[model samples]
Target: MTTIQPTHRRGATRLTDAGRDIATMLWRDTIRTARQPEMLVFAVVMGVFFLVLFNYVFGGAIGAGAEVDYLQFLVPGVFVITALQGAQQSSMGLATDLAEGVTDRFRSLPMSQVAVIAGRTLADAFRNLVGLALVALLALVMGYRFDSATGAVAAILLATAVGFGFSWLGAAIAAKVRQPDMVGMLSMFWLFPLMLASTAFAPADSMPGWLQPFATYQPISVASDAVRGLCDGALDTGDLVLAVGWTVGLLAVFAPLSIRIYTETD
Candidate 1:
C-alpha cells in the first residue's frame, strides 16, 4: 500500500520549483561526466580527427573544382556533426540509466519527470559547447576564418539547435528501447544516411541526380548550408528559414512524445 502511493503520484507530478528540479538533474549529469572525463577526451579527439581528415585529405582535390574555400565550408558542417555527436551521447547515457534502474529510482521521487528529459538534453548541449569550442579553436589554427563574428555566433547557435532537435530524437529512442547499445546501433542507421547523404561532406551536385533531391532538402543539408553561409558570408535566407523550421518542428513533435515515453517506461 505504501509503495502504491508514489506510483500513483506519477500521473500528477509537475515541477513545484521548475528551476530547482531541472537544475538538480542537470547538475547530476554534469557531475557524472566530470567523474568520467575520458568520454570528453574521446569526443575532442574524434572532432579533431574529422577536421584534420577532411580539410587536409580532401581540401586540395575538392577545392580545385569548386569556387568556395574548402576549409571554410567544412568547419560549420563539422560543428553540426560535433553537436549531434553530443546528442548521441545523451541517448546512450539515458539508455544506460534506464538499463541500470536509475530512471525507476527517479520515477519514485516527487520531481517533475519532464525535468529529466529537459535536463538531460540541456546538459548534452552544454557538453557539445565544449566540443564546439575545441573544434573552432582548432579550425582557427588550421586557417579556417569566419566572415563576421556575429555570423559565426549565429551559425554556432544554429548548429547547437540542430543538435538539440536530434537530442530529443535520441531521448525518444532511449525511452523506447531502454538499452544503451541498441540505441547506438539503431541511431547509426539514420544518422549515417542523413549526415553523409547531405551537404556535410560534399556538395549536393556531386551526388547522383536521383539522390540529390533528398540530400539537398533534408534537415542536415539545410542546416549545413545555412551554417556554411553564415560563416562564409553567403547567407541564404531560404535555407536558414528551412533549418529553423526543421529544428522547431522536431522539438515540437518529439519533446512531448519523449516525455510521455519516458514517464511510461519501466
Candidate 2:
C-alpha cells in the first residue's frame, strides 16, 4: 500500500495541499446534498411554514407599531430561528458519518484532521445561505421589506456566520457522542426553548412577568434585536455590539470545545 504523505519544503509545512484537500471535502459534501436534496427541501419548507404562520398569527396581537411592517419585524425573527433550526443538518450529517466510519477513513488519509469538521461546517454555511435567501424571497412575496440595503446585507452575513459557528458546535457534539438521535434531540433542546423563551416570537416586554430578563439577554434575542434594528432603518450601536458579543462568545467557547472533542474522540 502506498502511503499518502504531507509534503514539506524548506522546513515550512506545505499548507496549499491541505487547503485543497479541505476544499475538496467541502465540495464533496455539498455535492452529496445536492444529489439527495430532501434535507435541504425540508429545511426550506419548515422556514416557509413558520414565516406564513407567525407573520399572520401573532402579528395582530403583538402590535409593536407599524414603523416597520409586522412581516418585516417577523422576518428577522424567522431568519434567526431558521438559522438555528438549520444547524440540525450539521449534527445529523456528522452523526451519520461517524456511525458509518467515514470519519475514520478521513483520519487515515494524509490530510489535516481539522478539515473534517471545518469543511462540513463550511458546506453547511453555504446550505444555510441558500435557506436564508429562499426565506427572504418568500417573505418579500408576503409583503416584507427592509429599509437599508447595507444593514440587510450585514444582518444576513452575520446570521450566516452565526449559522457557521453553530454548525461547528453541532458537528463537535455529534463527533463526540457518535449518535444521530441524541445529537438531534440535544440540538433541538437548545434551539426550541431559546426561540420560545426568548424575544424571538415577541417583544422583550411581552415576555412573561418573571422571564423578561432572561429572554432579553439570550443570544438569540440579541441577534434578533440587532437584525430588527437593521430592518427598521435604525442601526443602534448597542444592538450591533450585543450581536457581535454573542457570536464571538459562542464561537470562542464552542469552537475550541469541538476541536478538543474531535481530537480526543475515538
Candidate 3:
C-alpha cells in the first residue's frame, strides 16, 4: 500500500510553497517594473501635478478660507491620492496582462495561482512607496514639513497600506472584466467619486451640509485626516481607527473575491 502524507503536513507544505511562489512572482513583477520606467514616471508625474496645481491654483483661496497652511494640508491628501493612483495602475496592469494572455502562461505553471495577483499588488505597493517618497521630497522643496521623521514614515506606510487594500479591489475588477479599457473605466468610476467628494482636496466643512456626512466619513477623508494628523503632530485616534478599519474591510472583502474570480475566469 502506498503511504499518504498527513493532512496537517500537506497543509503546511502548501502554505510554504505558496509563500515561495509569491516571492518569486514579486521578483518577476519588480523586474518588469524596472524594465518599464515609464510606469514609474507616470505615477510620479501625477503626484507632482496635483501638488503643483493645488498649491498654486486653488491653494490661495482654500488656504485663506480654511485658515490653515494649504501646502501642509494638501501634501498628506496628495499622498493618499497618489497611493490610490497606484491601486488604479494595479487594476490596469493586471487587466492588460489578462487581455494579452500572460495569465494563461502563469496558469500552466505548477505554483500557487493566487500568487499572480498577490505579487502584482505587492509590486505595485513598492512602486507606490517610491512614488510617495518622490512626492514627499517635492513637498519638502515646496516648504511642507512633517512633524517628525517617524511621523512621516508612519504616514507613508499608512497610505501604502490603504493603497494595497484598494489594489485587491482593483484586481477583483480586472479578474472579472478581463478587459483593460473596461477596467480603467471601472476604476475611475469608484476612484473619482471618493476622491472628489472626500476631504482630500478641501475640508469637509467647506462642503454643503447634506454632503458633509459622506465627505467626512468616507475612506479617503479618514485617510487624509489620519495622515494629516501624523504630518501635523496632532494624531486623532478616531481618524486612525477609521482609516485602518477601511483598509482591513477592503482586504477582507476583495482579496478572496479577486482570487476566486481569477480562478473561475475562462
Query: TM-score of each candidate?
Result: 0.90, 0.89, 0.95
Ranking by lDDT: 3, 1, 2
Candidate 3 per-residue lDDT, tens place, 24-56, comes to 999999998999889989999999999999999
Q: lDDT per residue, candidate 1, 29-134, as tens digits?
A: 8888788787677767777877899888988888886788888778988987887777788888888877776777889996778888888888878777777878
Clashing residue pairs in candidate 3 (N, C-alpha, C atoms within 3 angstroms): none
**Ranking by TM-score, best first?**
3, 1, 2
Residue-level lDDT tens digits of model 2 in 1-266: 99876464543354776688789889888887788688778778888878888877777766555464567668888888788777777778878877886777887887777677777778878888888888888988888887877877777777777767677778778878878888888887777778788666778886677888889888888888887787668877797788888778777887778867877843
Top-TM-score structure, candidate number: 3
**Under the 3 Å rule for N, CA and C atoms, how many clashes does model 2 have?**
0
lDDT of each candidate versus the true structure: 0.85, 0.78, 0.93
Candidate 3 matches the true fold with a TM-score of 0.95
Candidate 2 vs. true structure, TM-score: 0.89
Model 3 error, position 210 (Å): 1.2
